[model samples]
Target: MNTLQRRNAIKDELQNQKLISAKKLALKYGVSRQTIVGDIALLRAQGQPIISTVSGYKYQEAGTAYHGVVVCQHTIEQTREELEAIISLGGEVVDVLIDHSVYGQIVGTLGLANQADINDFMSRVKNVNHNLLASLTNGIHLHNISCSDEKVFNSIQQRLDDLHFLYHD
Candidate 1:
């Protein structure tokens, strides 16, 4: 396929598959992974609602979902539990934000919406041996959560509070 065709195909694939990696897209289109990355960049530049997550790229449509940011502080060992608590209460961990000493604010797109996504993220955390963004700030960070309503977000907040994960003065 031509460049325009391949990029269009990539957009369609993202919409259909929900989440896919550049490697997978490259394999599917018989192109280099870099080429797929370029395609994704071009697509994003064109205002496509595509988001790259820890797992892969997924199309994110504008929605009426309630979004809230919660301050949290916990150990690395509590990462899974924190995420689980949020996901179990119908909260999507949209992203993690941390204030770095050098960099002002760093945001990591998580896109963790379920148990499976949490599992994959935990696995990657172990396998990648990379420090989570929170580690930089002594386990203090902010999570932008998306939920169906304020009620669900409240439940998630309560759960995190119960788990001693919510940071408060």
Candidate 2:
């Protein structure tokens, strides 16, 4: 297939699938992984709501009602507990961000909405040589979380506070 055709197929795949990996897409399309990455970048430039996560790419839909940013601090060992607290309280962990002394701001899309997503993310972190972005800044980071309403968002904050995951001055 042509480049345009392959990109179109990739966009369709994003809409149809929950998560897609660049490696898997390259294998399916008979292209290099770098090519798939470029295609995704082009698609994003053209206004696709594609988000890259640890698991894979996700096509974000506008069904969410409320979004809020939370500051959190915890050890690497407490990552799973923090995530569970947020997810169990009906918050979708949209992404994590940290300000680096050199790189400025770094962000990682999470899109973790359920226990399964959390499990996959945790497993990927444990099994791969990948390090959490928060690790760069001494376990302090920001999370953009989404929920159905402000009530749920507040509840998430409270739960995080209860768990001592919320950062405070």
Candidate 3:
């Protein structure tokens, strides 16, 4: 198949599967990993809601859940507690966003849907050079979290507030 066909196929695979690695895509399509990377770039340029996570590339799904952005301030040490609080309360931590003087709005996808995801994130933060966006903004950041219902959202808000992590403006 050609580049167009391969790209279309990649789009389909992403839509159908929760996550697929570039390596797996390359093997399936008989192309180099770089080819798959270019295909993903073109697909994203065409407006596909594809997000690359530590696990793999997947399509982000929007459902009936209520989504809200909560402002928070905390040290890097509190990252695990903050993430656990949200996930334990039935909220999916979608992303962390911060306003940078130079870059304007910057976002880092947590995609922390479960305990394992959060653990992996914290692990990478410790082992890699990935800087937390909050570091650039003096420990103030925002989390885009999704909840199944209003009650869950309220619980998350209350917990974060109690932890003194919620930024009040």
Q: Best by lDDT, which number?
A: 2
Each candidate structure's TM-score, on Cα atoms with residue i matched to residue i, is 0.96, 0.94, 0.88
Expressed as tens digits, the lDDT of each residue in 74-161 for candidate 2 is 9999999999999998999999999999999998888899999999999989988689999999999999999999999999999999
- Residue 111 lDDT, candidate 1, scale 0-100: 95
Rank by lDDT (best first): 2, 1, 3
Q: Candidate 3 on 7-40: residue-level lDDT in tens? A: 9889998999987889999999999999888889
| Model 1 spans > 4 angstroms off | none
The global C-alpha lDDT for each of the candidates, from Candidate 1 onward, is 0.92, 0.94, 0.88
TM-score of 3: 0.88
Candidate order by decreasing TM-score: 1, 2, 3
Candidate 1 residue-wise lDDT, 1-169, digit = tens: 7999999888888888878988899999999999988898899899998998888899985674799999999999999999999988988899999999999999999999989999999998999898999999999999999989999999999999999999997
After superposition, which runs of candidate 2 have C-alpha atoms over 4 Å from their true positions? none
Report residue 149 deviation for candidate 1 (angstroms): 0.6
Deviation from native of the Cα of residue 75 in model 1, angstroms: 0.5
Worst 10 residues of 3 by lDDT: 55-64
